[model samples]
Target chain A: MSQAVADRQETEERQTVGGRFARLMDMGDGALAFWLLLPTAVLLLAIIVYPVCRLIYTSFLSLSLTSGLPASFAGLQNYRDMFADPVFWSSFWNTVIITVVTVPGALVVGMALALIANIPFRQRWAFRLALLVPWALPLAFCGLIFAWFFQSDYGIVNDVLRRLGLPTVIWFNSYAWATVAICLTTIWKTSSFMALIILAGLQTIPRSLYEAAEIDGAGRVRQFFEITLPLLRPAIAVALIFRTITALQTFDIPYTMTRGGPGTSTVTLAMYIRQNTVDFLDLGYGSALAVAMFALSMIVTVFYLRMIRRGA
Target chain B: MKYGKTVLLALAGAVSMLPLQNASAETLHVFMHSYDMNLWQAVFDKYEASHKGIDIKVTVGGNTSEQQAQYLNTQMSAKDSTLDIINLDVVRPAQFAAAKWIMPLNDDLDGGTKYLDRYLSAYSKANVIDGEVAALPSRADAMMLFYRKDLLKKYDIDPPKTWSELSADAKKIQKQEGGDLQGLSFQGAAIEGAVCTFLLPYWSTGHTLVDKDGKLTFDMDAAVDSLKLWKGFVDDGVAPKNVAEIATDDTRQDFQRGAAIFAVEWPYAWNHFQNDADTAVKDKVGIVALPAVEGGKSATCLGGWQWGVSAYSNHKKDAVELTKYLASREVSKYIAIHGSLLPTFEDLYTDADVTKAVPWFADLLPVVQSAHARPVTPRYNEVSNAIRTTVNAVLAGQTSPEQGASQMQARLQRILR
Candidate 1:
């Protein structure tokens, strides 16, 4: 009875502190809040907002890299030209296909690895560390290694296939398979990152819950679907968000491996923007493409956030 | 009253010294890419030691065409006088000249045209647009055939004199050598280097990207034949199926590792092939011109960098002097020996000391003599990209060469307008 009274007193004290804080906010103590946020706000404004606005503004103008003259107002012509450009549409579709393929594939594989790692075993630590090696390696270095591995003639991949009496695959020449090869590299490099996140989520579920489910005649698979999956929703959503964003902006691997192809087969949206802005030096058109990419990313982000909220 | 008078006297004295300050503060700022910074520093040091009273501040940008474009555009747009001199790629001088961001050398500076004429004929012509000499050639590079002399001797095959001979010889060598060694290698990737090395054979066969009237002509049968020949190597198994993905460096490394019998590359590879530490074929490599197509003529594509004065420069005279110094024979020889850059002057190719130092130049000069520049236009980048895309499509078997050529022509026409 004394302990219960002590708990009630503590609850009342917390409520009183919260009430005072709410009253301060109601009385326009927002100034104190603004002061605390001012530095971060300024940083975001300078780094993010200003550059985006400038890029959008530049997209509306006619500019060339060679001439440093102020761009004349081009209005919507640059955007219109981009729509007519087959390279832009092809790369946009490529980005979508890669994102769609790699995201779900990574999630499934990641979850499986996480479950395997979560099981108590003699070498669980070793298995977990080994799984993370792919993720831990720097992306550009991995890309270089993949470039060598996929070489059609001298590469180990082709050599092994040839020895097995299988026809050699020309990785960069075949459009469909080249894209698959690139996607495989991305999935290999990124699945571990997702697995790590899922593993953390898996650890958070109580062992007593599983024991109770087993006592209630629920099998391991059924318990996983009914309880474990529902609890892992937040972690899966976070993984999807990160993987989708990264896959959408995939550049370095394709760049280092195939360089947007034998015939622009694997040119992602990021590579398209880079080629136009940097290689071709059409800043206005490049900026317009950048704006399009920015808009697309925001839409996807908003959709993911809503899904996460509904799942919660 | 006395304190106020004393303060006014001091201010007056400081004001009187302002002219001296202005006179002594003259400095010319130069913006160059990172690769050229060291060479430029050497040249600048020499200049500074000999000529006093002029200070130069150097800034290095990223070593890419994109970084160069950004730095030039941003700095020039701001009317910043600090970015006085710019180092430009071969294809870009015409575009920059047309844009008027760079000064018209013949009109703005003294002895510009005469100084430019000292460069190789084709290189000098690359910088001229609308009767303006916009830049001076600083360095020159042309593609050459690098072959394994040891492999040739062991296989009992002589250096190929023509395209047909090269193909036949490559096939024979590939048949005999059972290991990872391939017969021939070149850049077939869909990038700038591929176009540089492969287009030479095409151009030598009298195929051109554009005509005199700026009309697109790459859709001709010769262009298709050229594409077919380049793709033929992969189909015949003389070149690897991954040839379409091999970069210039990759192809060079393959030859250096004795995995390839022959390679089409630039002079830079000569030094690498001769370097004992990196190459298995060291002291066994031979240089030759690209073989002629159809027992006819041969050509090489010209690749190099040039120096130009920015139009926004406040110190035009100083910038011009610096450019002239860079183009001087002494500096050219210094770069050849230390920097491994090929000189653009004709005399340097024949100089006994230079030939003794490089040795490869004796054979490289003949190739450079017949080297062709890509179509010079304000829209050359667009044209070059279109050609590369279409050619790559053909090479990858995504489209027929004839269809790809027609598409390239259409794109070229659109850009030319």
Candidate 2:
């Protein structure tokens, strides 16, 4: 009997405390909003803000695993070393090149595929399913598949070229062709995702606009240029921003296909960071590299936001 | 009230059973690469079957040594205690010992130096650090020349002992075969094998990459000659035009499929050639020490795996016991017969069962005895990268041999100093 009474008293006390907190939240709308967002703010701090701060802090130290020396403060030394390193410059340029080439390449391919899929057909679900397949494939798997396809001796591309009475190209051995191959693969893997996003934008365009344009004698090409392109700007912007960010961080495809070979010509900044942190076990230098990558991403994202705001 | 009491009693029972279950079977986790997982799993199962109340859990790692090292290094650096035993590549024991990630095994073994006499001297020496045994050799490997025995006999040519003769023989065979048959296939890609590829010819010039003290003692002219020799093969149509893209497995695949007349590969390819279902070169393959540079001695690179007990393992004593069993001559002979993995023990090389399984093991003793290890230093990865990238660059026609050698020297000097 005494245990039952104690449990009831504890339950009532908890209810009263919760009720008091709820009443306190009801004092103002601003306070209610703050209370509602506290959990998310706490989570974001724990996951993102804490790690970023640690990364920045570690970047200012000299922590080399192979050296067998204790870590010591070395302000700006890693950054100084990075600026003087030729490999860093080369990898940075390669990352920029990947972003510049693949983003526009995917956009064009994706636009065509999106328009094709938007056509009214009875079996439209099949077309939609096909669009999802490549987008759903793993990046590393795509890299491996394309690597086999582009192999010098027995690759299907060279085989086809041989059958066509053309000279076959060595895909992965040459710097120019290796970069082209990885860029081509990145476009192929990512274009379908862009297509899916644009398809959603295509659905929002009312049929009445196309109908009015058709009645006004506007050709298919003209209507597409004016109406479709104009109406799809927002979706394209979103896809471009997302794709550009990912392109700057490209690692898996090139890693699987070339492993940053041919004299490290295809190495991206992310791969350089991996080589430093994981391969060489130079945490301080790798953290600095990461901070540079983070800054690059932030600048690119901010530029896109500004452009979007201005366009709006 | 009665229901609540019963629920509490049930929770207490479940909590108490956890310790009982743990006490019944002590689990030891062993991590190794996926390539040897099945064969090693059999050994683990044998150990588990013999030892009651002990459960052995195996974790398979990546395909490449570099990949496995990266994964293990990350885990060990974080002091992860989950992995009780680790299999390290031959090049990594020194680095792991320097970092104190692996425990010294002298205390566990019976005055460990006594047991060292059972294995090949070079491999056994690789595990000893500061008069303490840091690891025990599990298997041994070395680069060798793999040729089509049928083709050599058809041409009435003996296995070439010099690089020029080998090249001449390869070109002659290519001319005779006459239809898209590549003369040679070797790993020229920027990877771990490329380091051995660079070191093979360089070592033939009677130069050690690093002195016994782990100090750089590189010979630039010899390095240039080594670079030029590999580049010449590609340039003169002796090797594939895109040989720069070929990795270790690529050469293995090419040789196994009979696409190449000669290949430089590890001993593992011998097993595949003799046994694999898809091999076209079955009963047609021959192995020899890699061809020497003219007027220089023949040398091949040493490679093997080792067993190390993790410093962070809670069950260190049990892990060392398991390591001993795995490294025993009995287990080594079983692996030699079953998996065709070269045993580290000298007697196993001459064991009747092993010799019957791998007939060439009788001649392999000299090669294994003289094989050179890569530069043993904590900065070995950087050293390896420097050499491999230079080799790749020279082979890909991106840099001249002279330029690549100088560049490699500059990079290695900076790293080593």
Candidate 3:
């Protein structure tokens, strides 16, 4: 073709692109917002939606990686097997027990820390920084550290108990004690995070409310219960939801410390899922367990949301 | 325009360096447990030095078998080609072979059966699966009874030959060394070693967890007796009350620090006890076979690592060659001298250098030869979990030995089925 014809074709292409740009610029706010967000929406669909769908689909199959059998659809067989699995129930109860114990334990301890840190002081920033240290530490690192700290023979806890002339308790040998150790570690690791969030909420409370309570002749405890606790509901809810979800998915501490030991006594749902998928190579059953865990988390989230809405 | 020229020149230079990166050499990546990274890296470096144009990149995985297996499982499941060679624990080869994640060495090793004979007989037997060699032994290990020789001598007790004898000896030693002194230390945690802890006594009772056909040959009476033996120790204060928390390293560290009278551990601890600067038990530790049940013969759990060429590896030829070299008698002897790692080759056990460096290697050969590799099956992980967890439960006092045995039998049947 001639150079002039090529130039004309390029102009036409530029005009079309310019026209599309012009149209986009002329769009309404909602449509423009959607167009701008489409990339992220598609990305979310690919990464999050696809895997979740794959998980659900895989859960219905009998795809054992080491079984040397071809992948075949098994309908509800995986779920059926999981329901009958004694490990599933034990892990489920373990997860539930951990969540139930750790959430409140963290909230109370976090509130105490937040209240302590919130005090008007010259080195409040340093105090806050120190409070955030546990929050920033890696979960597995915390687990390992606590595992050593609670070591039956040379551990500091038993050593102190022995020094104090008290009978030393074995922290990780029995199920109840192992569970307690795990809960203590989880609370220690997570309470700081909860405190940070609750501290943010604590700062947001108008001093006028506290002042009014003080003027009404309220004591420190009464003011905390009446003003601080009531006003801190939203922050507490948010913190609780985050903490509860993570608590339900507890893996690191129990794994590093007990490895769901003392007979699967402290194996959380997440650890059991890993045991199936990674250790046993039973992907189908693992997926089923994962889906159950996901459903449980979703139900808890929904319940919290509904409760929050009712409160509002 | 002048600034644009510099930017373009910089971009051109960067692009030019890209090919230089690829032009270096063929890289063979090796994945291994972190416990002996330095020793393995030395072996790899030796291979690299000899075999020019080949770069061996080593990826150190976690120390525990579970941790190593978890990482490899994910990588192999994804058909990751980046990892060409993997060092697997003894129990993992069957699982890895069943998953088809590793290549069969029969064709590569020139009809691998004859090549397998180069290693100790048990390791040689373990390498073959369904008439194919799945992996070759890199080292040899077996659970051995490590005792305080000085303490036993001071207390006028010989090495215990049976579980009851061991218990009595431990109690006697503990009584004499009362303050903060424990009788025994062994792995009771929910780790791979715990399976051995359970199997040691069970095997002593003349029972195997599985039959020749990989069938569940779990003897309830024997298993219960085995569990009861461990529980009795914890209950009677022969072992620590919190024995369930002890892992492989815990036992080693406890015994090394002079906190325990005896430790049930692998051969690796021999080096640490005799060489480490802080070891209180150095020159005082003695190695022997694990104690048997009252009327039964002595037994131990076999352990060691094996080398496998990944099926997904792009450089299978190079990887196989490296594995062949690593599994050779020359490297085995070197490891024996340098790392004090037991050699897979039977002849290396008697080699003058190995015997001089590790005098007990010659004696360990017989124990290792007779040591049982935990029921070779694709479902060995599940089998291990069943036995280890039930053993832990009995030790933890969560269930009676009878209940634990029954639970284990049920779990094994389901797993085998």
Candidate 4:
């Protein structure tokens, strides 16, 4: 009872900051609240907001590294050039396609892995480690390992296919296959992360509820559908949003495997921006593309958040 | 109050001159990449030993051309006076010269810059853009065609002298030798090497990206035929099917793996092919210039490095003298013998000492003689990117050679304008 009291007091102290913020906000104590938020607000303004605003500002200028002239404001001409660039559209589509394929694929696989890992197996901890190994590997190492597996000449993937009398395809040789290969590599690396998050959500469900459903003559599938999934919605939503953002910003696997080659089929917007900014030294244009990407990501994230809120 | 302020100002000025008197060391900050660091350090030490109150402070970048470009672009564009000299790519002299980032060497190069005449004409001419010798030729490299002498002898064939003959022999060899051995391998990835490989045919056929007047002289017919030949190398299953994805390093490794009959590579591959210990074709390999295009002139893509003084350098005299010393015959000979680099000096090609150290330097002379530098334009980055994309598209089979040529024309127009 004393420990419970201590816990309640601790919770209250945690809430004191929140409560003070709410009360201060409600009572129109603008000065006090501003003073309280000064550090955080300044940090955000400098670190995050300033760079973004600079990028947006740079987007409207003509800055060339190879030239001696000072930068002049072009005012949406960079945007116009971006839209006119076919390479930009191709990279945009590549990012979209990779996200569309990898997110759902990871989710489904992750859900299955989470369920399997949650089963009453004797070596469940060992199984968990086995499943988590892919996520543990660094993303660059994962890309290189996958590249070796899918390498056309002597890679084990093709070797297995050839042994099985299946026609082997050159993995990173075409627009379609290179995109597919990148997606596969990304999904393999990221699904473990999704599973770890979803598994945590699965552990939070009350055991009594499942037992009661079992006693009420509910089949395994019915119990899963009725008791498990509905309660798991928040976890799935969180996982989905996290994975989607990561997938949208995909760079490592594609860049490492293909270097945006085979005719720029696997280049994400990140790669395109890098090529323009660093490789081509077109900083102004690259920053414009970066700003556009940020805006698109924001819109998508908002849409996803709204959908999640409605679903819950 | 005015008298007191004047006294304070005089004291401050006198105080500022104290450090100037104590440390009057003149430092030349040299920007270079470590192709041969030991040789550079030794040369710097030798120079610093002879000259007092002058030190050569070297800044080294790792061997990524991108990093070099970024470093120079950042430092030079800001007009930073700290960097006194730059070891730049041969192809970049025009761009840097046009932008006034690197200084012209006319007044400093040994009284009228007569040292330029001692270097190979092709490489020396590469440094001169718009009547200004903006850079000093520091090193020389050219493409060489390496082939298996044993395979040619076994197949009862002479070395090919033209593209048609080369393709015909490659097809026959592939038919007889089976799929275990690929006929040819070359860099076709959308990077710089692709341009080098593609340039052989394009320039051999006497096609230049720009005319003598610097106008875009993109000939569609020659470009299509050139690209068609490249695509045919893959389509006919002589080169690897995934040739579109191979970089220069991959080409070297593939050839080293004894997986290809012939490979187009730079002079750097010679030592690796002979002495890498794992090379199965160590004694079996021989090199020749790339085959001509039947009716076209013989051509090879020249590649190397050049040294230039920074326009914003504080010690311009020291920087220029340092460049001259770095490219001196002693240094070039040392680089050639020790670093496996081709000396930029024309006389070193026939030097008995160099030939004693490396027997194959003799054969490289004719290839270097006829070698053409890639288009010397201020818009080289844009132009090269456009060509790389077009040729890469053809290699990927995304577009036909003719279509790629048309795309090239469009992109070149937008950029050249």
The candidate that wins on DockQ is: 3
Q: List pairs with backbone clashes in candidate 1.
A: none
Proportion of native contacts kept per candidate: 0.41, 0.59, 0.80, 0.41
As a whole number from 0 to 100, the lDDT of residue B139 in candidate 2 is: 91
Q: Report the C-alpha displacement of residue A129, candidate 1, in angstroms.
A: 6.0
Real interface contacts reproduced by model 3, as a fraction: 0.80
A119 Cα displacement, candidate 4 (Å): 2.6
Off by over 4 Å in 4: A1-28, B1-60, B64-85, B98-107, B110-115, B129-132, B153-156, B174-179, B212-214, B253-259, B274-276, B282-284, B310-317, B337-340, B355-366, B396-399
Assess every candidate by TM-score. 0.78, 0.85, 0.85, 0.85
DockQ of each: 0.24, 0.45, 0.55, 0.29
**Model 3 C-alpha lDDT per residue in residues B98-129, reported as the tens digit of each score:** 88999998888875688887678888888888
Taking every candidate in turn, the Cα RMSD to the unseen true structure, in Å, is 8.3, 6.5, 6.5, 8.3
> If you score just chain A, what TM-score does every candidate get?
0.89, 0.93, 0.92, 0.89
Q: Looking at candidate 2, what is the lDDT of residue A69?
A: 74
Which residue pairs does candidate 3 place in steric collision?
Answer: none
Identify the superior model by DockQ, candidate 3 or candidate 4: 3
TM-score of chain B of 2: 0.95
A223 Cα displacement, candidate 4 (Å): 2.3
**What DockQ was computed for model 1?**
0.24
